[model samples]
Target: MSRDVVPTYVGTSFHVCSDRAADISRSGSRTSSLISSPSSVRTVTRRQSTSANTLLTLDPRRSRSPSRTESGDLIVRQPAKRVPLVRRTQHEAGPATPQSSAMSDAAKIQLVCTLGPASLDPDVIRKLDARGVDLFRLNLSHTGLEELAATVEFFRRHSEAPLSLDTEGAQVRCGSVVPDLVLAQGAEVELTADEVQGSADRLSLRPRSTFQALRPRSRVGIDFHGVLLRVIETGPASARAVVDRGGRIGSNKAVTIDPSPILPALTDKDVAAIAIGRRMGIDHYALSFATSGRAVRRIRELIPPGAHLISKIESRAGVQNMDGIIEASDAVLLDRGDLSREVPLEEVPYYQKAIARRANRLRKPLYVATNLLESMVLNSRPTVAEVNDVANTLLDGAHGLVLAAETAIGVDPVGAVDMVKRAIEAFERIPVGLDFTAPGAETDGALLTLR
Candidate 1:
């Protein structure tokens, strides 16, 4: 061994050979000295290396024993594994304030847009999806199941949020009207109890027998909120009426008799809507004439698992059963239009506040759905009052907002969405809550709202 040779410890055992090997070509005389003691000798065979790692083999017989490991040539210990971080459905998002630079791109309001001609393009749907439209509402009341299903697919393919189907539930409506036919005040209109399954596309001055069930002094309403009419004459062939809340009764408009105290709510149309909604991959069925908890359950039974049921407070029964309905439903829709007719128009604001406050207290996500952006239907701009109404509804802690004709068949669907988006930004800028998820913790709604 060279006098300069020194010993080193790799780990705690097996000493390396330092006495130079014999027989190759040296003139030096060296004595045989096993660097590895037989009692604690261990061996590590180096195999072929590959990739970014190397394979090492240690036969147990030659593996490091406790005795050898105390002074081993190589310390073979497992490397500490690194855990990959996975993110949840949560986002570190703040309020969507236009003025605040801290806004998170993921923060969004679950805006539900009704599908119609106004916004049908695939590209437009994609844009709306990216713009934070969280859900799509397919008004099954008017569209066929096939078309509705297709539209639902379109919506789903475009965005995976969810779809809401408005049931055709037994909402009364005026007979379909002819284009430009105006029902002036004091004008007589006829309806028939026996409605032909045939679609009524063109309006006729001729009276139909559908009004036979109506009695003298019977009050009928069109569009639910547009016009309130009274029966002047009733017969098998024709009925007559005068307009009170006189807007022109138009095509496919609803005709509702002032619900008697005895009339049961939610017609067969609503049941059909519920069935179709269940058939589709819809996430929610907005109960049209949800009068009570029973009414909501009536529809919920027919829906799929994880599907949400929303009771709409638009009728006297809904108002009377408000607490029960809210408790039964996953959410509730405060419809201003039907509320105007079912309850006195002047009382709507009061009820709106009452319902909103109660819904907020209960923690169920509440949505204010109606003609919020009505001005967008005509001009590209929305009225200031309309904007303020959106802001106020947000301030009241509504979880979602809806658009109707303004987005359904209006001229500028994108602009209407933009208008709504801008309104949301303005409303969120005026923060009222530290956290918006009031009802449930870690719920999808809560997570979305917090985002």
Candidate 2:
């Protein structure tokens, strides 16, 4: 039998279903009887009012049923079973585009833009929104409570994109160092626990616990390993180090130490920020440096009930505990920046693909963040390599791509957003299969042949 297709609205979009046999069996030939008899048939079709994602079923008996008009032609009206369409924000992205309609929930690429001085303006936010920004991230590490509240209020007034408050999990960073101190090779410097205006010879670091963990001959990296320093001596609240690799160091840059110290998952500032965020009705929270399932559950408890918890995997512990963390959280985020501190730079890509595949298997959303368009931080266009990387990330099972400095502090914030949108579209255009299996895939010989 030729299948009868019924076109109906699942949400705002129309979905076609083919299940005429079930409808016929349920209606007991009443439809056939009416269709066979034209005299009793009437063209009575009323479209259910759909206002702003309202879910309403189309009933053929009352409105949309096949009938015969005066022209002696059969008119077929589609009737669909009731299916509730739950509304989701862009952050919880679903396959909405026609090209992506058949894609599963994991295939929808969410565009997450971090709000910063460059893109925090109302106009820029609106532009990013128009380009389809799914979520706006507020880095708690860089924001105080008052400023965080104000920023949250400001975005609420401007855009409807969901806000994500990213906690500053256990990490060390350089305190106020003015004039961009350029440390030369073999230059001796002092890293103090005391807060001070830093200079070439002396600097301060935060989370004194990490300073206390330092030992003689320990290797330290500053500003994403821009400059390398080795500890020459340790003190009660400080450490003296000699520069091994020279580079310009700036204020608020990340600092990494060998034998990373054990710190609390949530900082005092993070708790304060969460309290402020809860008051503001923010429902999305990203826990930075999420090391284990226990930590994810802990943060999940602190947030509002039913709020989306995104665990950021950036440390060695995080990678080791990936399965448990992915199982515990609503979603997972692969932070390649801080992750490199523990993981070698060359191995980052391998980790990214592995994390993406794991997240896909566990049916959780995974967002890749950091340096997506690094060159665009100063330049108007992204590097070719960066574009390729974005596309490959999607192919590797990343449900979303996050623009940090690219949209937050880049020279052309809107342009960066546009590029991300373009990258997603380009990825969708490719017909590459992400889940491919070789014949007898379990065997090493088959796997090698496929490779």
lDDT (CA) per prediction: 0.56, 0.71
lDDT of 2 by residue, 1-451 (tens): 0012122222222111112222332444322211222333344334543431222343444333223433544433222221111224724533123243443332346888898899889899888888877788999877766688888889888898789999988788888887957899999999998889889889988877787789999988988747999999999899899999998888777788887778778988899899988887788899998888889888877888878888999987787778888889878899999888776576676567557756655667788999999999999998999998887676556777899988878999999988988888765543222111444433532121110
Error of 1 at 255 (Å): 3.0
Write candidate 1's Cα lDDT for 78-146 as tens digits. 111111111111121211122433322213455778888877777777777777676677775567655
Output the number of the lDDT-best candidate: 2
* Model 2 worst lDDT run, 10 consecutive residues: 10-19
Clash pairs detected, candidate 2: none
Instruction: Judging by TM-score against the true structure, name the best candidate.
Output: 2
